[model samples]
Target: MTDRPTDLSSPPTPQPVRRSLLSARKFALMASVVAGLGAGLYGFSPAPDHFNVLSTAAHAQVNNEVRKVAQPVGFADIVERVKPWVISVKVNINEKVAKNDDSAEDSPFQPGSPMERFFRRFGGPDGMPPGLRGGRGGRGAVTGQGSGFFISDDGYAVTNNHVVDGADKVEVTTDDGRTFKAKVIGTDPRTDLALIKVEGGNNFPFAKLAEGKPRIGDWVLAVGNPFGLGGTVTAGIVSASGRDIGNGPYDDFIQIDAPVNKGNSGGPAFDTAGEVMGVNTAIYSPSGGSVGIAFSIPASTVKTVVAQLKDKGSVSRGWIGVQIQPVTQEIADSLGLKKADGALVAEPQADGPAAKAGIQSGDVITGVNDQPVKDARELARTIGGFAPGNSVKLTVIHKGQDKVVNLTLGQLPNTIEAKADVDRGDRGDATRGSDIPRLGLTLAPAGSVAGAGKDGVVVTEVDPKSPAAERGFKEGDVILEVAGKSVASPSEVREVLAAAKTENKNSVLIRVRSGGSSRFVAVPLAKG
Candidate 1:
């Protein structure tokens, strides 16, 4: 029938069962061959030792020198050890008084500024919740919470200065949920540290400060009262050290990545060893919450400030009595210094210790007591570290000459104003402006100008496009000194400029006095 007309389109189906049996037989043969090979390899391989699973022969092909790393478990042990020492501090502050009182200085940050937000004192009146703030015209006393830890057995504890500042009543609740009335022993506003004495306890659990500085990347545990939640714990690492956040002159804060929030101020950041690494004081936040950037006063600073606060009710720091600025490369080049370092004396205060010890405005303080002065801030911190009336040997670079001046530091006053400002009176018809060669300045004698004092030449006009203007010279700026020499007339400045050019100097250093302060400017000497 298939050959009759051809169902030629359909192929023949033949021996399906036989083909299947052949394929099964071939797969079975391949399986047997693989099994035989595996058995042979197993017979040649050495048997694993039951007693010594990690023997040398077992790992002969592996690199034994590779270190096996494991993840850290958790900070639970550290938290358990240090949690007993943490306390929640409650302060009753009159919001109306805190807003108007001079106690605002107790806070390093302003009340309503962005820095206030960045470094907001958690227990301060502004840091409290809106509901907790005074309800009726903001005139009632409001309560706020902060964090603190006991430092001694006799109920002596450490908290933030802002926490106890202007407090009508101070109280602390321990980890055990017991509240005690505490009194502020002392407070240091400069460092924002405070010492308080908790009543009704003689033997309390305490925490020890870490002996050395916490290294960056070291695991840290922050224990505190965050958002009124007592004994809250967060984990992170030490982000940095010696950070200056413009808090104050002595702003050597340890930056941490711990999630510290409001009410965490005055808390303790502990190391893995359960020792206090720093006291959490401020946080850098844009939305008024922790963004993983928090600042703490290092244990070193806390030790020093707390010691002083414990001794007396106030803190006194050493002051050199000089207005200083960082030494820039331009200033170094103009002054023939090989390296730009140390602090430049912008102006030594009148009758100040630095002025009395022969320190001049043009001098550069290179070192203090044999230690290098890193910058203006370092010099301030170094001097402040010493007690008042302490003798200090200052290495100074005065007018290109290196000299050591021995001076006793004075007590930093509660209120130390910055450098005095120059009184630039009404720019009446000053003397006709005179031009200096290669300098874009129209100068006039200070005595000829009505409001300008008779100490230096006054800048009648500055070419907006000139090097002088670019160097921060303003029309009313008084040129106090040119090339280390005081100038009273335009001719004196010209003479100094000519002399500097003759000496093949690329720039001339001039001390300029502006509205309220004096600073040195290095003006480039354009070639004729």
Candidate 2:
């Protein structure tokens, strides 16, 4: 009776929540329909080509460009062109051996002896008898093999000097198995290049030397008779230029990676264009086989040396009588130079061209005929490039002053003895001095030290960290001259140092003698 009044005035009764449940089959069917719709949507969706078209197009363009500028896929064409010019050189060397006074039966080390067998078992190939081991001794002809290339149409070929040097007879075999007797036209040992001619052939296939320098990384083909394997071809790229392997005084060489081996020496290294870029000469290998590091005589050097060999039987280089050393930064500082460059004259021969031109020790050769000399080796090469009797203007710095001196170069002697005459001056009274902390040196008269002569001041003590020590000055070194002025006492050295300071110079050039040898050293002045 009160429900109508309570609902109107207070609260109403709560209603029950309603729940709907489906059958398992119907739920599975509904899930399957939803998945099918998702699959169809995904399958019918357009590909991402609209967004990736630019990148794909860019990649395709790059590939097309690469196809146009790629390197040669094969060197077959180059090999075919250059193989005909390559030849195998066989040489017969007639080496004379001194007759042994002892008979084979009397000798303990002769072939078939007990010592020979012992050595053969223990020493490997080196222990075998000279005769049995194919060594060059006794009264028989020794055979050698090398490679070369025809340089001219008349069968003029180029090869290493060592290959045909002192050969009793020389033979050349072409790629087609044609062999001919070759006459050695000339050989230059300095350059290790030789010229030989085959009189029987005319209009023969030949290779042309490239006029331009081969750039590093340029593809190269090495065609030669490696290990007596005729017409063998190997390819690589130029590894470096202007390499020096100390083969000789003129050691400028082109380095390549063309798999050169024993018989490959004296063969031509051709560019991809089939032009001779260099002549293979040496290989750097620890196992006596190819390690990919090889050296070649540059085409420019070959051209010059070959032309000279053909014209004259020898190579003549200009010589100036001076023993030179590189101008180090310390030496340059001591000489008051702006930079450490050029060659420093360590000694001038008494009657040599440099001495005749008044060039003396402690002079820095800065230039030859206005061309800058980089170092001692460059100076040697520049001078050697000139012919004897040619007059060259040398720009030299002496006592911190640049001077031009003209001198006629003399022919280089076959044997040059670079000996410097030490100036053993008269002995003087002993003198003492306290340590000069700036130079980190303690000095005394040379005569004060027992066996030290009196021509200069002896360095008694040297601070290991001083500028003097940094410039290679050491105790027992005798300072013969300071700033080109001879000093016989510590007082003289002090006087020269004071004078250099007065002149506001940063360094002082000193001539030092140690171990019976003398050299010029530039020592920097300690800052105040």
Question: Residue by residue across 392-424, what tens digits does model 2's lDDT show?
Answer: 999999878999999999998865344343333
Candidate 2: how large is its RMSD?
17.3
* TM-score of every candidate relative to the true structure: 0.78, 0.68
Compared to the true structure, candidate 1 yields what TM-score? 0.78
Give the lDDT of residue 246 in candidate 1: 72
RMSD of each: 11.9, 17.3
lDDT of 1 by residue, 335-412 (tens): 889999999998998999999999999899999889898888888888999999999999999878999999999999
The whole-model C-alpha lDDT of candidate 1 against the native structure comes to: 0.80
